[model samples]
Target: MKTILAILAGATLALAATAAPAQTLKSVKDRGELLCGVSKGLQGFSAPDASGKWTGFDVDVCRALAAAIFNDPNKVSFVPLTADERFPALKDGKIDVLSRNSTWTLEREAKLGLLFTAINYYDGQGFLVRDARKVTSALELDKSKVCVQAGTTAESTTKDYFAANSMALELVTLPTSGDLVKAYEDGKCDTITTDVSQLYALRLTMAKPADHIVLPDVISKEPLGPVVRQGDDQWFNLVKWTIFAMINAEELGVATNTLDAAVKSQKPEVKRLVGTEGNYGEQLGVSNDFVVRIVKAVGNYGESFERNVGAASKLGIPRGINQLWSMGGILYAPPVR
Candidate 1:
C-alpha cells in the first residue's frame, strides 16, 4: 500500500509539471488582453504616435496575436521597455510576449531561459556615421568612438568586430536607445552602431537625417524576432504560428484588402488557412478562423512590412533578405496543411 501511494504521488507531480506551462494561454484569455513588451520608442519598429497610440512593426505582431485569440486586434496593452528591462519583464510574467527589436542569440535562449519565436526581421549589425566623415565602410571607422545601447548584443558585437579587425574602439554604452541617440547627436561619439534596419530609424531622429549615412559593412547577422518565456510550449507555439500565418498568408497572395477574396479562394492552402478546410488553428488551441482574424486585423506579413518598415514607411528600407523566397529573398514559411 505504501509503495502504491508513492507511485501515485509521483505520477500526480509529473502531471502537474506538464500542466503548469500550459497556463499562459488560459491566463491570457482570463485577463482579456495580451500584454506585449516593446521598445520605448524605435520609430518604424515600435513607437507611440502623437496621440499616445502605439504603431509600428512590433506593435502589429502583438495586435495580430490578440486578433487570433480574441478576434479583436486592439485587445493588447503595449508595455514599453528599455533594453535592460525587456527580458526581466517577460520572465516575470509582466508581459506575455516580447515584441521588441531583440536579437536571437544562443546565450539569450540557453542562459536566460527565453525562447525566440521566429525571425520576424532579418537584420545585420552596421555603423551609422556622419556623412561629413566620408566613411563608407565599417573598416574606415578604426579608433572611432561608437555609441551603443547597454545590455544589447550590439555592444559585444562592436567590441568583437573592432578587436578582431585589429582596430581600436571606444564604446559609449547608454542604458537606452534614446540615450544612445542623444550621445551620438551631441558629438559624444563619432559613430553609432546597431542593426542596419535600426540605423535608418535612428537616422530619422537626428537633427539632419540626410547628413548621416549607414555604412556598407554588415559585421554580424542579427536575426531580430519576438520572444517568450521558455517552458510554455503551448504559448510558444501560438506566437510562432502567428508569425508563420502572416508569412504564409503573404506567400498565398493574401492581404488586408484581399481577405474577402481569400475567404472564397478555391486553393487548398487558402481553404486550410481561411478555415474552410482542416482546423489548423483549433489544433493550436485557437479558433479555426484564427488566420482570418489575423489577416483582417494586421494584413499579411508583406503588407505589415511595407506599411511599417518597408518602402511605404519613412524608413524606406528595401526588402532584401526579408522578401519572400519565391521573390529572390529567403522569407519562407511552412505550409498550413
Candidate 2:
C-alpha cells in the first residue's frame, strides 16, 4: 500500500508540474496578445520605429510564434527588457519566451534552469573604436579601457581575451548597452566590446558613423537565441519548431513570393514544413498550417535576416555563419518529419 501511494503521489506531482499557464494556447488566443521579452532598443534586432510598430529580427520570432498559436502575427505585445532582466522575466512567467540576443551558455542552461530553443544569430565578440584611433588589431589595445555591459557574454569574453595574452586593460562595466555606448562616447573607455553584429548596430547611434571601425578579430562564439523556462516541454517544442520551420522553409525554397507554388509540390520536406504532409501543427496545439502562417506572415529565416540586418539594411550584417548549410554556413534544420 505504501509503495502504491508513493507512485500515485509522484504521478500527481508530474501532472501538476506540466499544468503551468502557458499550456493553454487558448488563453493566449483569448487574450489576443502574446507578451514577448526583447531588447529595449537594438536597431535591426528588436526596436520600434517612430510609428510604434515593433520591427527587427527578434520581432519576427515573436510574430512567427504568435502567428503559429493565434493565427495573427500582430497579436503580440513587446516587453522591453535589459540584459539582466531577460532570464528573470522569462523564469517568472512574465513573458512567454525571451527573444533578446541572449547567448546560450552552459552556466545559464544548467544553473538557471532554462533552455535555448534555436540560434537566430551565430556571432562573436569584437571591439569597435574610433576610426581616428587607427588601431587595427585588438592585440594592440594593451592598456586601453573597454566599455562592457555587466552580466553579459562581453564581460567574460573581454576577461578571457585579456588574460589569454597577458594583456593589461582597464574594464568599465556598464549597466546596459545604452550605458555602454554612452560611456564609450564619453571617453570613459577607449573601446566598447560586444558581439560583432551588435558592434555594427551600435555604430549607427554614433554622431559620425564613419568615425568608428569594428575590429576584424572575433574573440568568442556567440550563438544567440530565444530561451524558455525549463519544464514546459510543449511550449519549448512550439518555440523550437517554429524556428525550424522558418529555416526549413528557406531551404525548401518556400518564400512568400513563391509560397503558393511551393505549397503545391509533393516534396516531403516542403510538405512537412508547410503543414501539407502531416498534422505537425495539431501536435503543437496550433493550427494545421502553423508553419505556413509563419512563412507567409513574417517570412522565412533568410528573408527576415535580409530585411533587418543584411546588406540592404543600415546594419548590413553579412550572413556569414548564419547562412544555411547548403550555402556553406552552419545553419541547418533537422528533418521536419
Candidate 3:
C-alpha cells in the first residue's frame, strides 16, 4: 500500500509539471491581446504617425502574431521601449515578445536566459562619416573621435574591433541615437558607429544625407530577431513558427491581396499553409487559419519588410543580406508541411 501511494504521488507530480506548457494557449486566449515590445520611435523600425498609430517592420511582427492568435491582426498592444529597457520588459512579462531589432548572440541566449525565434535580418555593424572627411575605410579612422550609444552591443563591438586591430580611436559616449547624431553633425565626433541598417535609417532623416555616407565596412554579423523569455518551450515555438509562417507565405507566393485566390491554390505548400490540408496550428494553440490570418493581415515577410525599410522606403536599404536564400541571401524558413 505504501509503495503504491508513493508511485501515484510521483506520477501525479510528473504529469503536473509536464502539463504546464499547455497553459500558455489558454492564458493568451483569455487575455485577448498580444503584448508586443517595440522600439521608442526608430523610424522605419517602430514609430507612431500623426494619427498616433504604430507602424514599422517590428510593429508588423507584433500585429502578425496577434492575427495568428485572435484571427485579427489589429488585436495587439504596442509597448514602445528603449534599447536598455527592451530586454527587461520581455523578461518580466511586461511584453510577450521583443520584436525590436534585437541581435541574437550566444551570450544573450545562454547567459541572459532569453530565446530568439528566428533571424529575420542578417545585419552588421558599420561606420557613418561626413562625406567631406573623405575616409572610406574603418581602419583609416585612427585616433578619430567616434560617437556611440552609451550602453549597446554596438559600442562593445566597436571597441573590440578597434582594440584588436591596435587602432587608437576616441570613444565619445552619447545617451541616445539622436544625441549621437547631433554630436556627429557638430563634428564632435569624426564618425558615428552603429548597425548598418540604423545608420541608413538615421541618415534618411538628417538634413543633408548627401553630405554623409556609410562605409562599406561590415564589422560584425548581427543576426537580429524576435526575443522572448527563457523557459516555456511551447511559447517559444508559437512565436518561432508564427514568424516562419510569414516567411513561408512569401516563398509560397501568398499575400494579403492574393489570399482569396490562394484558398483555391491546389499546391501542396499553399494548401497546408491556408488550412486546406494540415493541423499545424492546432499544435500551437491557434486555429487552423492562423497562417492565413497573418498573411492577410500584413501581407508576407518581404512585403512588410520592404514597405518599412527596403529600397522603396526612405531608408533606401537594399535587400542585400536579407533576401531569400534562393535569391542569394540568407533568409530561409523550415518546411511548413
Highest TM-score, which number? 1
TM-score of each model, in listed order: 0.97, 0.95, 0.93
Superposed model 1: Cα runs more than 4 Å off: 1-8, 11-15
Q: What are the per-residue Cα lDDT tens digits for candidate 2 across 1-337?
A: 9999999999999898777545635556777888899998999999999998899998999999999987889889999999889899888878888999989999999999899998878989999998897899999889999999887979978988999999998999987889988998888998999999889999999888899999999999899999987877788888999898899888888999988987788888788777788898999888778988998889999999999999879999889889999999999888777
28 Cα displacement, candidate 1 (Å): 1.1
Q: What is the C-alpha RMSD of each candidate to the true structure, in Å?
A: 1.4, 2.0, 2.4
Query: What does candidate 3's lDDT look like per residue over 251-331, in tens digits?
Result: 888998889988899999899998888898887878888899998888899998889999768887899978888888888
Cα lDDT of all candidates, in order? 0.93, 0.89, 0.86
lDDT of 2 at 206: 89
Ranking by lDDT: 1, 2, 3
Using TM-score as the yardstick, the better of models 1 and 3 is 1
Best by lDDT: 1
- Model 3 clash pairs? none
**RMSD (Cα, Å) of candidate 2?**
2.0
Clashing pairs in 1: none
